[model samples]
Target chain A: MRQEHKETMKRRRRNIKLTVAYDGTAYHGFQRQNKCVAVQNVLEEILPAVFGDSIEIAAAGRTDAGVHARGQVVNFFSDGMIPIENIPKAANRLLPKDIVVTEAQEADRDFSALHSAKSKIYVYQLYHSKVPDPLLHRYSWQYEYKLCLADMRKALTLVTGEHDFSAFRAAGGALGMNPVRTIYEAECKQEGAMLTFRFWGNGFLYHMVRNIVGTVVKVGNGRLSPDNFAEIMQAKDRNKAGKTAPARGLTLWHVNY
Target chain B: MRQEHKETMKRRRRNIKLTVAYDGTAYHGFQRQNKCVAVQNVLEEILPAVFGDSIEIAAAGRTDAGVHARGQVVNFFSDGMIPIENIPKAANRLLPKDIVVTEAQEADRDFSALHSAKSKIYVYQLYHSKVPDPLLHRYSWQYEYKLCLADMRKALTLVTGEHDFSAFRAAGGALGMNPVRTIYEAECKQEGAMLTFRFWGNGFLYHMVRNIVGTVVKVGNGRLSPDNFAEIMQAKDRNKAGKTAPARGLTLWHVNY
Candidate 1:
């Protein structure tokens, strides 16, 4: 009877992973908050009703306020027997129109959506235009000035591979945290008025992508040269970087397990 | 003195044209409403403040609620002398984030934005997926079933050329309105999960694009045949067609001079 009860407990506690996508325009952020609504709070509040289980979710990244995610991964142990295929549809029925659970899968009990991820890809979108575009405002930033794509490309090459990114960290980041991170790839692509910056890294420090974009925009606008960009990276001081770009322009694009 | 005053009045009544774009998710519709906020209400209220004159605007199309527009045209008479180049910038400063005046130009005094348009183009967007996509919910309709694009394309050809389209007109449209209209072009393009239908026409009947889209989607899903679509067009009966697709999927793409 003891062994049977233990097996039943093991069967009940299944680790389920969900791939979430959100507009992020309405939520304060992906993390839970006290007074303000966040993506995390919505998920936790709504998921229990769908799965009939008390739940806690661990997300791959805690995106800041106004930040969006297309392939955000989260894992939680479920005490209910809802079929894996039905999870997305069930959760989506209860979630708001801005948030969606795109996919769900059962994983090994030890799988961690945060720690077990190998890398993540983030994309920052901006459009060069004299006037704002309403359709693109929720997903992209608008810059009135023209950007030199060649200069931005040259500066992007400096961000590849492992390097100390302390200069790119925001002011309120944890003290004594490791500032070195491996950026497998960094690229800039332009199509007409739109510019996209893609970054693939093992892990990113707080506000790292926005800082890099800000400093890179400076280079694109001829305020800083590629050499100056290199110097800022080597300085390892937050004050050496340019202003942080707005959160709405960045999206957590994908995560690799 | 009387002659001079007449000349001054003529000069002050210069006609101006604006190319407008908006994300219509929050608006009631393009036309002004008694109590509900609308795109027209926002524009009429703000443009007058920018131009320093009481303004009246005539738009190229009156889009329904939740329908977006990328190149809606509007013509208005301005008594003030603001530089044409600065009009977009000045108006955008006071306009809400969801609406923008993209361009401004002086037009002929007799030019009418609604009556002088040669043709207009509208696009309907939809995506086939098992689960809803949060990023696209505002701009596209999500269909859970697979669509046969080839069949949809075949049916779209029937929509081209001059036709009496009373069957596609929505209820409450002007009674005894002429149903004969020229469809300059009708085409469908599919990429991945997205399907876009483009209609270029001299003029579309009320809910014509939406009603056609509803019928075409039914054809794509195998509920109706291309022959059935042709018969519906010939029937000139609203009851013969499928349901009107949601307004969110339709966009006023452009207007030709």
Candidate 2:
């Protein structure tokens, strides 16, 4: 790094961190896309209007379409003089109703929303009912048949700790990316007709959480035993896992720094 | 009643009751309107398709535009041969995604959904936040100011029991209708930033619940005292009450027969 460029960057207020929450049903995804509206596109357009400076942001996770987030981290560099406390308030007013800037703060010059050390917690929601609920359809998957909660619990227990998750990664994932990741916690809890599966992990491959949820649901439905789930994990083949669950059921719950 | 009309009505199967749940954002209201789409319009259209006979339904309440319902009750006389259990399943398949038939059953020959002796429960939802939540804005009213819970509770106590609630009635209410009604239960409960006001009553005059809510909110925000709220009720004039809260925050919770 050039000393002059480093000194220039250090003297200016360059890094701003923001926590965002969004309803992803109207967005294409978290990343910017040329042909479709994305969360990033809206953020980039609104931040400039709020801060009086064009800004580019880096996000912790690029969530897929129809996947909501309650605590998505983002960071950008801006020399504009808006107070950190007012950024979220100002941005929220100008941004579309589907996106919100929940928190904002000044950060160290070199900090990055993407490169920051962190683990994430994701939750997949499901409700078992003979008839679907109109109010909950946007946020949860409605499954008609009764599930074997005991069998699904066993399947989740096998999902904890480090493993090569090749069997769960979707195609078109980054080339040459490592498939091994550590899963700190994987558990399912049911209350009456509603069920929630929460997964906390250091990192996850594309579609890993959804694929695992789909496979665990099959076990709950008695199509496969706990042993079969273990075997699929050991096989380390994407074809061995079940189909990915619908995107509407998934929510990026939080990120732990 | 004529003997032949009575015998023919008694001999045929009739009076099927339905408990419906709907996301009312897409519909103008629960009643059929000439120019705009409504929940009743959709229900009336879809019921005939499912029962193979034209059906006219009577509802317990006529909810206003953008007002939701969790357990709104309706009844229709049908001579069709579809089994009782299959009615909901068949209607659900034919109904729009925003409306659902949650339960259906057989009712007595003389059942009249609107005229049946019954009470009703209504719930109004609110959340206090500096920034509006896009996801919850459709279902809950977002108030930015802090509320005095103690004052709100005091106002709710005064709302119970039978009273001539003309102060809370809106314009265009039924002509010559009795304004006095019995409120069996009236209470407000708060959890964190969320507040829910529930009213169980023999009947509600048009806009009575919403007008009372708006007036009580004034007391909570220090604009009016609890004594002022009681005075408003005593005034027995609509102009003495506060404005009506938005329709989005109100829901027809349930009907008791």
Candidate 3:
């Protein structure tokens, strides 16, 4: 708004960080692909029309297909003088009903959505029921068998803190190929028929959270004990761990910056 | 199967009442129409095909287009011996993703979906926010204006007893043509940005619950006062009430049989 603030960036355009929320049921995922329609593709298709500029963007998470998000972050460079207050409502006007930009803030030119140092949180939801609830079938995994919550909580303790997560990682489009990560918290909460697994971490390897969930579910189901889960983590072998949970049950909750 | 027990009715079919839940966005209301795909048509189209018989069914509430329901009840006479426990899952298999048969039970021929009921409950959900929430926009009413909850609760008290609801009823489809109905319970509950108005009544007329919600919203928004609400009820004129709220915000929550 002021000339001095504009001069601080030296002729470069302003960077905007937007908070996004999406249902993700109708999307291919968060990352833009050539043939498939992703949340990124939807934003790319609509944001340009609103801003009148070709914009390149970066996202906090590249969620797999069928995965949802409530607090995903994105950043883009724009030369237009559109007010930040107008971005979210204007973007929603053109974007599809499933995806929406919730918040828009002008950021320093050097800030990034994926980088700039922060943690992230993800939640995995399960509908514990003898019969599937059609209402929750789209958003939660339906599990019919009995589960030991105490055993699952004990199994959760085995996955936290800094660890070499090679056992949990699955081959995917990860840039650094890093296997070590810092998990700040791992907890399970059950309310009525819905059970949620919350994970707060500095970073996660591909499929790490889901793999941990699968292993913990085995512990809860009595297929594997809590001590066995600790052994599985120590083995550092993907095959030794339980199967990876489905992407539909996982949601990227929030990104810390 | 016990043939003697069933044969006591003498060629009469048993009536089955189904507890149905649906996201009614794609439906043209609950009643069957020749031109559009209604929930009734979908049920009629699928149920007969599943049982190999032409079945006529009736519902407790005929929800409007774009309205949702959690506990809508429908009854159909059937000679088929499909297990009651298997009906819900079996019906869901044939039904579309939006509508689901949640529960089923066999009832005597005297039980009617529309008549042999004590009361019904309805809920209208409102999402209060300055910006639209994409995830909730489908099922909730997005309202950005300021509201006074105390005044709304007071306004709610004026509608919770037996009264001539001519001020609330819209003249359309009526067989008995009675304007008198008894509201058993009426209250407003707020959790964060979502406000839910719960109404339990012996019976409701055409657009009656929605009409009351519209008037309550007017009181909340300060466009109409609580005293004016009482005066409007006494006037017994449809023109004295507020505008009819949109169908998308209303849901058939439950039925007492």
Candidate 4:
């Protein structure tokens, strides 16, 4: 009976799952770094203050600087002193104005945000116009040339499915790690002068999405044919891809896990 | 013939009308203020640099701090050296990143953005949720309440048509000026958890739209019945009205000339 009580007490140490959202314009990235403001640093700073105890958190992905997030997930072990319903309010009061803890849930004690088995959705917005759109400037990239949606669709086909994405990966990216990733969904949706690219993949390299978007834009501009794009993909060379797209236009939209 | 040529040259000193948009989170307001940064100051600083000389300007209405603008119009007189088409690019290069000159056109020299206006449109955004939404923090107000849409719509009816809005005006509103204004269209539009209050009027008193929104929200939450709302409008007393909503939710949506 004593042993059973101890096991129950151990299970009571709750794993708190959080769905977070941030503007990311004023953050270095999602991970904590030296001499920089990160989303993790702020969350770490506030959690201790709100709960009156230090806590460690693990995020699903390390989003780059200036990359927004709507449904980024994180998890941490807690003593379960604060009620689940009040956790969001308590954390938001101490967090920065640009960062918000949108949802909080008590999960199994063994749950881990990083090791969850599923995919992620990232979105990159681009607009074509001579004049900059003030409202969308912080959230979208502005380009001059009008892109052919049909060609962009053709390019998107090359990005989907399982593949060795070394050609689309950036230099200095995750050394010694495999570059194989399966893209579940890749498409460009147009609304007026804006084009939104939505990408859902099992995993991504340091700059995989941005690099793919750049190459697809080249295809839309009539510079690269579908066969040429396939060549760039099979080349297994980083230099074969087009320029890396801007970070401000990218958003970590959702995590399927 | 000399007199006619002089008049033509005088008219050639054309007035440039500009359509402006801005994210007002970082600005004190649309008008110039001491010490604090204002959208007008940024525009004033950039205009001279782009035009190669000082240029005075006027806006349709002075938006409050934390208020955004999508179709705010401004006008200025200048020598037609910088070609009307090139003004947006030149000004945008010098203006702050938050403010944008979206459109520029030559207008009559007698045109004034503050005067010669037919109506103005203002929009207030609100979201109902228990937790904070980081992506919309700068663009909307989050309220924790289950609001009745029918009650909110009924409240909107009490706000339309020409009426003495002394009850809705803020303190120090125009220094004993006429409290009566004509409202052409006023309604509440709901899209999911988002509620948008649109107001079109010949003119608005200081804090008029915000005050109306607060009252409408009160009605939505069942604090004030539709009859109580109508009484507040007819009471012509600021004390009878509900509280003024936050400035972040307000936007100067458009100005019709």
Clash totals for all candidate models: 0, 0, 0, 0
- lDDT value, candidate 1, whole model: 0.90
Q: What would the per-residue lDDT of candidate 4 be over residues B1-257, giving only the tens digit for each residue?
A: 97785455445477889999999989999998889999998898889877775766789999999999999999876674898888888888888778989999888877889998899999999988777677777888889887999999988887889999998999767756899999999998989778999999999999999999998998999999999998888888888788899998999999999
Between candidates 3 and 4, the TM-score winner: 4
Real interface contacts reproduced by model 2, as a fraction: 0.67
Segments in model 3 whose C-alpha atoms lie over 4 Å from true places: A1-11, A171-176, B1-11, B171-176
TM-score of 1: 0.95
Best by lDDT: 1
Per-residue error for A187 in candidate 3, Å, reads: 1.0
RMSD of each: 3.9, 3.3, 4.9, 4.6
Tens-digit lDDT track for model 1 on A230-252?
99999887887788988889999
- lDDT accuracy of residue B35 in candidate 2: 97
DockQ of each: 0.81, 0.62, 0.44, 0.68
List, residue by residue over B1-257, the lDDT tens digit for candidate 2: 57775565456677898999998988899999889999999999999888787777789999989999998999987788999999888999898877999999899888777889489999999888887776677788889987898999999899999999998998778859999999999999888888999999999999988898888888899898999889888988788777898888899999999
| Residue B124, model 2: Cα distance from true site in angstroms | 1.5
Residue pairs whose backbone atoms clash in candidate 1: none
Please name the candidate that would achieve the greatest TM-score relative to the true structure: 1
Model 1 lDDT per residue over B64-170, tens place: 99999999999887787888998988999899889999989899987889999999999999878887888789999888886888899888999999999998999
Q: Work out the iRMS of candidate 3.
A: 2.0
- Interface Cα root-mean-square deviation for all models: 0.8, 1.4, 2.0, 1.2
- DockQ-based class of model 1: high
- Candidate ranking under lDDT, highest first, comes to 1, 2, 4, 3
